[model samples]
Target chain A: MMKKSDLYIFAILIIVCVLKLVQIGYSRINFSTDILLNSFKKNYGEHIALKKDIIEAKKLLIENEITNFNLSEELMSNGYFKQRIVEFSYPIRLNETSKAVISLRNKSNTCKLKSKLNDLKLYEC
Target chain B: MNVKSTHHQDSKLLIICLLISSAIFLNYFFWAINALSFLKYVNFSILIFLISYFLVSREFKKYNFIKLFFLSLLILCLGSALTDWDARSVWLFHAKRIYIDNDLYGGFDNYMPELMNAYPLIAPSLSATLAKLIGHWNEIFPKSTNILLVLPAVLIQCFFLKDSKFKLMWLMFILLFSGRILINGRTDGLVAIYFVSCCLVIFKLFIGKNLNFLSIKNKKINRSIILVLGILFGIILTLLKNEGFVIMFIIFISTIFFKLLTKRNFSFEDLFFWIFIFLPIIIWKFMATTGGVYPRIIGFGIEAVYSESLTQRIIIRLTDLDNYKLILDYLILNEKFIISLIIFGFAFLKNFKKNEMIFKFVIFNSIIYYFLLYFIYLSTPHDISWHLNSSAHRVLISIVLLLTYFSILSFQGKKN
Candidate 1:
């Protein structure tokens, strides 16, 4: 019942879908580290992790591949505004090229993490 | 066609639907102007608009597909967490600031200079409206507004695509193009939808005869109604994104050429109406520039362009095959672009003789848009490759959609 051209078109579509899925999978693996860094940087002050221990929380983030964390919402609801620069060590191997440096300034209320990735070389924050 | 006199009620209905969508978008812009003083009022108004949109979407004869589109859109929005840096750093962050401070420029300190805080506020204002309605900002509601803003354009498209085959093709196109970026609170996808829809509307008004409701022999009342709707869409298209202005300009300028080629004069009244609608954007830009919030383009300085290093940078980027290869890789990785090219090829073959002028207009616009993109890349002072890597694909998404939409319009359907 199927025409040869129809079969060919179907095959091409399947191939395209497969290629897209593989591409997405590859990007997820690659950007996982950056995503983790961003979560920490965004929620540094307003999250529950800030009230307990900043360095330990960041350590968890750096080690794990967690993409979504609401630590800030919990911390803010509990009445704590994190306003200190909490520095911790992270493996350069975690993200070979990208480096995230998060500094939570007390006076500025601005938590910024500078992340730059170019060549596949390890760097420190 | 026997001197068509009666109105095409379906076309009028389509125009009303588009107007409702434009009204909602413009409501956002209105809030942005006096956002601080009228914060609560704007939020309340936006609530009303959303409710109205839900009720009005049912007014269409075939509302099932639109409902499915929204349902799928909701699923897509909730499925993914917002991890895109641009979404968090710029768009959603701006929305959160508006929600907290109840003003457009709420958290100015958080705005990086490069984020273009002064860019038109349609996307951010709508996001803020959604956050206000939900009573809090967690990410999902604010980002969902992207799909909400595009819903009207989708509805207008559904009207044109009455055939089952065309409907299926459109659904396939939507699924293919609605990848992570579209639902992830990005303006690029919103911009693409608005620009393509605006072009399609313009084409229908000027060159195509499908909008039989808007025939020239209609009463003066109908003519004025068409003029007002055309002006409103043109303005909304310009306000959608900076590139939107360029796209609309290309369309407008090419309209003149196409009209002349066809031995007809481009309507001066339409041009005047479009400019009148565009006055708000000019005023917005003037205010931003005067307020010193807008960052001046670094590469625009003559001294910079003539600088030996800058010239070398431009030359290197222009001559590099690797840069072209990077774009190709991005396109190839996404099946949407390949399919768009294939559809365009088929459409061109089918409509080559029938709609040559409009077909040429579409191709001309695309070639010019591509060249403008390349020039921007060459002139940008940022890390050229990084800039392209991050944005080239996003912008190309718009172009591919534009081409696909044009092909759909050009294809000789039974209705056409």
Candidate 2:
């Protein structure tokens, strides 16, 4: 029921639409990639800061007995950690000899305490 | 020959397109913004409608030039980021707030008094809805929504030209496509396209041919279609911007005057249909007024008109040749106005006396628009020079489209 010319016209339209789709997809990908990169850099900086706080907390525990101890409370009060970390890690009572080793893990191991080595420092894995 | 009822079909399609865009806008207002849910599924449905509306429509697919041109414009729009200050600071900024908050009222943070948060939500609603659908806000896709708003009017214009000579069609294409506003993510072009198309539909349906009561069996169907289309366009015209509402009022008044002279009658159904179409704006205004979101603009009041400085302001503006010089330079240097003038001259010469009443309506509508612009400039709340210099050209787009449309109709011969 359609003419050859109509078919040609439709083909041209389809081709143009494909080109448009490619353009949109390509631009969006580039934009999203840039944003993701920036956010990753920001998150990496936060991890570094969290490591510093853990180091400070370890030193405090080594020096004196902490009566009211909440690692998240200390870190958060210092304005470095976001809310998600509060629920992940729980408060622990430490002896003077025992060292707290803080390391960053994948999302699944976010607040879990991994194997403690001889070093009393914090590690971000 | 096939274009006999082309204008009728064009009106219907234009209304359908605007209504869809309006639906998207209102969906954000009443539903998406409140739920705090992105309504990604609804947005997906809209995308399907957008693609199929053009790609699958037999009328559109047959017009290769228009189809390719429209798709290319969409591609260009999507590829570009939001760069215009008004686009970035005013339009898309509003969209960002609404999209993030998912609350229409909370979106008012970006709507500062001087920045005009008082403007309507239709354009921002579309952009915000696009961002919601995408689940993240990027500068490009949301602005690309302008193309979606523009496509319907452009396609309807193309349909109106379906039977014209190829050369004429190309000319119309070049003229309409040359505007920078179309690509720059501004609502001015959208307003211009819709308002001009609204006027065209009105003229075609009322003043031209459909007047003979005895000839057609489908008259009732045709009248019902126009009534529905008018109400749809009326709703959109008002919601697009404040100026849009004024233009719609002018059209309403002018059409009623013409109808009275012609002794055309309407049923109670027509009145109710109009009331239904206008209900959205009525509710919107009620919210705005009761909530004190925006102060009522009292431009028409006797108090404002008879203010002590009216004469002083008028004399001062008129005496300043700089204002005339700036307006002249702006109009002359603008490509849209030049093309519009040429086409109007050609149409006036070719169809000198044919469709005189229609041309009168065109001229009347144009004068009312320009007069309002001139009056606003004269009594502006901002610096007059800056106000006129910045906006005169953008506002002229509606008039240019009006003249060009009538010129095209003239070129198509008097049979329409």
Candidate 3:
């Protein structure tokens, strides 16, 4: 026959087991806001500037300094937008190289944006 | 003459108890918020109290509760300190991966899929659940989570030791003090508990011929309970780790071997018990194999280039003595060795007659299982060393269970 003491011990053990299960269950419902923020920062932060670069590259290509441009392919491959541009001032005096200057400015602008985005805190979205 | 000795002992016990309580309280108070969730820490405290209560009040009535409590605390403290170095970053972090994704099958993207899936789901699943609930799956949570996993086994151990006439208090003290238990929280501890429970149930049911099936006695009900408990224990073992199934298989085979060797008539009830114990394991194996949870071996076939390469790697690693030494050190020094010794001692000393038969069968089966795995590891193509190291604890679950059973059986004999 099962003794009363044995039953009590069993009951206590069962209660302990139930308590553990409940505690574990309770902990599962809570989400870590910090982890979510960190994940968002890691995944999304790197792509932000690459997105802006495509836009700037598109504007520069439309201004007609660079030629033989395919924006869709460029955007797909290098995050740079492609567009046709006519230019004649290369290998000449600084004053006449307005189109070249515009292309240089666009390239630098994209590069600067990329670097700035890279500088953002990894865990900051 | 009696009052003075009693008064002195009571004061000594009170002091020891106070010290243990303070130490545990302080330890928990400091780490409770940062490492462990509030509920988990509290639960752990409750568990310790329960263990102390059982051991001091009933099992070893001669021993003062306070002294045993202190000894347990010291053991835990030492074990934790010794094994605390790299586990936080390795196993505990891996557990966090399970929690974050909430898919035990979804392999850790950072590690190889095979390597990631090598670990059983129970420990990680529990950690994941805790992480999910706590809102922060930090390193501390998983490490501290080991306490819960170890509790059932420890409690069952107490039950096993209850009737033991030996200085079980000292044995408990030694087991607790053993450093391995403190170091890492893994699934092997649970496996040990399950194995011990299985033995206890088996012992309770089949120990003496006094409880025969043909007799109009409680034997029938008892046998049914044993069958149910054995099956439940086996399923729990299988779920905890893949090696758990191996242990169950060994136990089952051992039982059959024992019956056959002894010339015991196998009846429907015996068959039913075996079926009950083994059905879940077989079903699980089928599911695991079919589900592609583990790689399946078909008929003997020629090895591919990749398979050949893996075989070479496994061979080289196995041949390296240094690697084996490192693994042995890691496993033995950690809580497993002490626990195993105590269980083995108890089993060898107490369960000498029929119980020993079961123990020997189990030991034989375990040896075979271990050797088979070793041979397979020797032929594996990848860094089997890394895989083995990671899953080492899981492998020891059976041994732990066997020892636990022995310990329990030893104590159970004391009652008679």
The candidate that wins on TM-score is 1
How do the residues A27-46 of candidate 3 rate in per-residue lDDT, one tens digit apiece? 42122333224422312221
Which portions of model 2 miss their true places by more than 4 Å? Answer: A1-125, B1-40, B57-60, B107-111, B164-178, B211-223, B266-270, B295-312, B319-321, B331-335
Clashing pairs in 2: A103-A123, A104-A124
User: How would you class the docking of model 2?
Assistant: incorrect
Question: What DockQ do the predictions score, one after another?
Answer: 0.06, 0.03, 0.02
Q: Chain A TM-score, candidate 2? A: 0.26
* Ranking of all candidate structures by their DockQ, best first: 1, 2, 3
TM-score for predicted model 3 compared with the true structure: 0.50
lDDT of 2 by residue, A69-94 (tens): 33332333442332212211212332
In model 3, what is the error at residue B139, expressed in angstroms? 2.2
lDDT, candidates in the order shown? 0.57, 0.57, 0.44
Model 3, B1-416: lDDT tens digits are 25445334333333333333233333322332224454544544554565466346533343533234334333332223112322432344445555554444444232322223444444554555555555663323344445444443343334334332333432343233322433245445556556655555554454333433222444354455445544545555665656566666666676666666767777886677767656645654564455555531211222432345555656666678975775565455447645666667766775656455546655665567667666555554434555456655555555654654455454444332
Q: Give the local distance difference test score of model 1.
A: 0.57
Error of 1 at B313 (Å): 3.6
| Residue-level lDDT for B141 in candidate 3 | 36
Q: Rank the candidates by lDDT, best first.
A: 2, 1, 3
**For candidate 1, lDDT tens digit of each residue in B1-416?**
12221235444555566566656656666565664535545544654565356546544434454555555555555444564656755677666666666776543432344445666666777776766655655534566667667766766665566543454456446556644566676778877777677666666666554454345555455545555656666666676667777777887776666667767655677668667767767776676666666533444322343354656777877688886776566545556667788888899998878777667877877778877777777766676666777887788777788778767766644433
